[model samples]
Target: MSEARKLLVLVGSPRRDGNTAMLAEGVQRGAAASGTQATLRFADDYITDFLRDCRTCRRSDGECAISDRFRTLFLEDFLPADGVVFCTPIYWYGMSGQTKTFFDRTFCYYAGSYPQSEEVLEAMCRKRIGLVLASEETYPGAALGIIHQIQEFSRYTHSEFVGTVGGIGNRRGEVAHDPRDPMRGAERLGREMFTRHYADYRADTPRSTGVWCG
Candidate 1:
């Protein structure tokens, strides 16, 4: 039989058992049921420092000067994954600091600073990207900024933007009681993570007009 697809889930929340973590767990379960090997990693555990000035800290070999676990997490866990899911609690109406820092460090690869820049870019293009967010507000646009950011990231990397799941909650474990049932959506997204392709409904539907649901 063919090898199982690998999924890397980066949890950006500091709270190990918070609302965001719960949603991530649901996604993992769904991915597992679909025969995917899911690896859940906490950003707080591996990432300690933010991306620094590349001019002063970058190495000749294209590695970041700041020493941390992020390098290994990126080169080994992230680059090898067939699908990647970013799980973060919406902080100040955007992705958490950990998640933002993780993306910031990828600048080296995109800047062609790496020796294997071409290969790294190629690998990124072949993967599928997903997002999971938990927030205190259920407002319509609370998570829009993050969603747009992830969409743009996928576009820039030439990867498929699978989808996103947003949960509403303030206290720990409150997401489980959300009426919107974001956990279920998270699971569904995970199950289809490997096979789903994003499409603009407005473009696909000929009769569509200027109405924006989101």
Candidate 2:
């Protein structure tokens, strides 16, 4: 067996064990089946009251200057993780505030004053990104904008966009009842993600380099 890849899962639902959480757990379960080490972080708790100010955000270090709950964890865990999964509930055709805001904080990586700032930012972009969303609507269009945002973000950072899975639900744990069996699809996505072993690739140089998408 190959080395197990590390996956950082960000759950954006205020309800820790809500529908989105269950869907995320399906992905985790599938990743584990393929020998992946998946870490789940609740984005609702991870996002703090910290707002952005370029002066304060672009510190010497490649991290957010604000002393918030997510600052240290994002900088530390993100560096070592092989892939990231943003599991969010749809909010008015957009991602949950917790999910979008957390991603906005990534601006600190490219804005930092460190000499290797660009290199660090580029390296940070190498990880694979996946999305898991839950919406109350029956139509899949609710996740369109959110999907486009991830696609654009991946293009900007040079990260590989894996794919997205969406479910229809409103009440807690309702995603599990999705007629399409979304949890199974989520598990399959997670399993296939690591089966390719693309997450293990690393760019050792601090300069510009290509990322492994497969």
Candidate 3:
């Protein structure tokens, strides 16, 4: 028997049953149909309070210092997952502060203070595939910027950027209500993930070598 693949979906919206959640649900449906384990995690459950910019983890065990509810996510759930899906609603032309903060805190692991070899970071990246699903009712640039952020994340971490699905002109379950919109795209993305073993193709080098879109 083959091992079951695992995909982690992170919902960055504070509201439950929102557009982001709906998209994540679609992705989960696809993953399950393909025989993969799809895990959904909501940021509302992970974030307790606003992050106050404590970089202590950089100085210590390469772990975030403000350690509260999110620590387990950073240490356990995130690192071990075979793939990652970030679903965030556009806020102020970018990702929600909650999602941004979560990515920012990961700087602890990248600071290289734990004496772990670059090989370790490379392995972490190679083992993961990242997906971003964002939506906004207005300017599509916001969603584009969020995707760019994910691309940059993959580049620096040497991870795989599997692509993103953005739904424009939608708000508060608008996409969810429409059956032909995001859910269809999200499910297709999930199906694609199941067919490919992302970890095998991901490398420490960018796909275009500094030309962006890693």
Candidate 4:
């Protein structure tokens, strides 16, 4: 039998058991049921330092200069995964600070500052990416920024941007009661993360007229 696929879920929410966490848990369960090995990492627990300067304390081996738990997590858990899901609660119409910081630190790998940049890029090209967002606002545009960012990230890495799940909630465990039932959508996204291929709208269709559909 072929080896099972690996999925790394990076939760950028500070709350341990909040609305965002609930959506992530649903993803984990569905991924597990689909025979994918899903690993969840809370960003607040591992990522401590914000990336200030890539050249300040640059390592000779081309690794991130900042000394933090994220270094190990990126090298061991993230780089090897077949798929990656970024789960965050929307903050001020954007991704959470933790999520943005994580992406900012990844500049080293894609900027050719890393010794194994070619290999890392190759791995990224083969992976699939997904987004999970939790927001208090039911407004359609609330999660748009996060979605666009992830979509562009996937394009830059040459990875497939599978899709997204946006959960509307504020209180702890409130997402479970969202009328839209985003928990189920999160689960569906997880199950299809590795198998689904979304066509690029820019390449396959006419430019959008900025109309809000959701």
Candidate of highest lDDT: 1
Scored by CA lDDT, what does every candidate get? 0.87, 0.78, 0.69, 0.86
Which residue pairs show backbone clashes in model 1?
Answer: none
Window of ten residues with lowest summed lDDT in model 4: 205-214
TM-score of 3: 0.77
TM-score comparison, 1 vs 2, better candidate: 1
- Model 2 per-residue lDDT tens digits across residues 57-163: 55565445666677555766765788888899988999988887787776665554545566658667767888899999988677889999988887776778887
Decoy 1 TM-score against native: 0.89
lDDT (Cα, tens digit) per residue for candidate 4, span 15-65: 989998889988998899999999999988878888766677678877776
Candidate 2 lDDT score relative to the true structure: 0.78
Give the better candidate number (3 or 4) by TM-score.
Answer: 4
Q: Looking at candidate 1, what is the lDDT of residue 178? A: 95
Higher-ranked by TM-score: 1 or 3: 1
Error of 1 at 194 (Å): 1.5
TM-score for each of the candidates: 0.89, 0.83, 0.77, 0.89
Model 2 clash tally, residue pairs = 0
The regions of model 3 sitting more than 4 angstroms off are 49-64, 114-123, 127-130, 169-171, 177-180, 194-214
Q: Report the number of backbone clashes for model 1.
A: 0
By TM-score, is 2 or 3 better? Answer: 2
Clashing residue pairs in candidate 4 are none
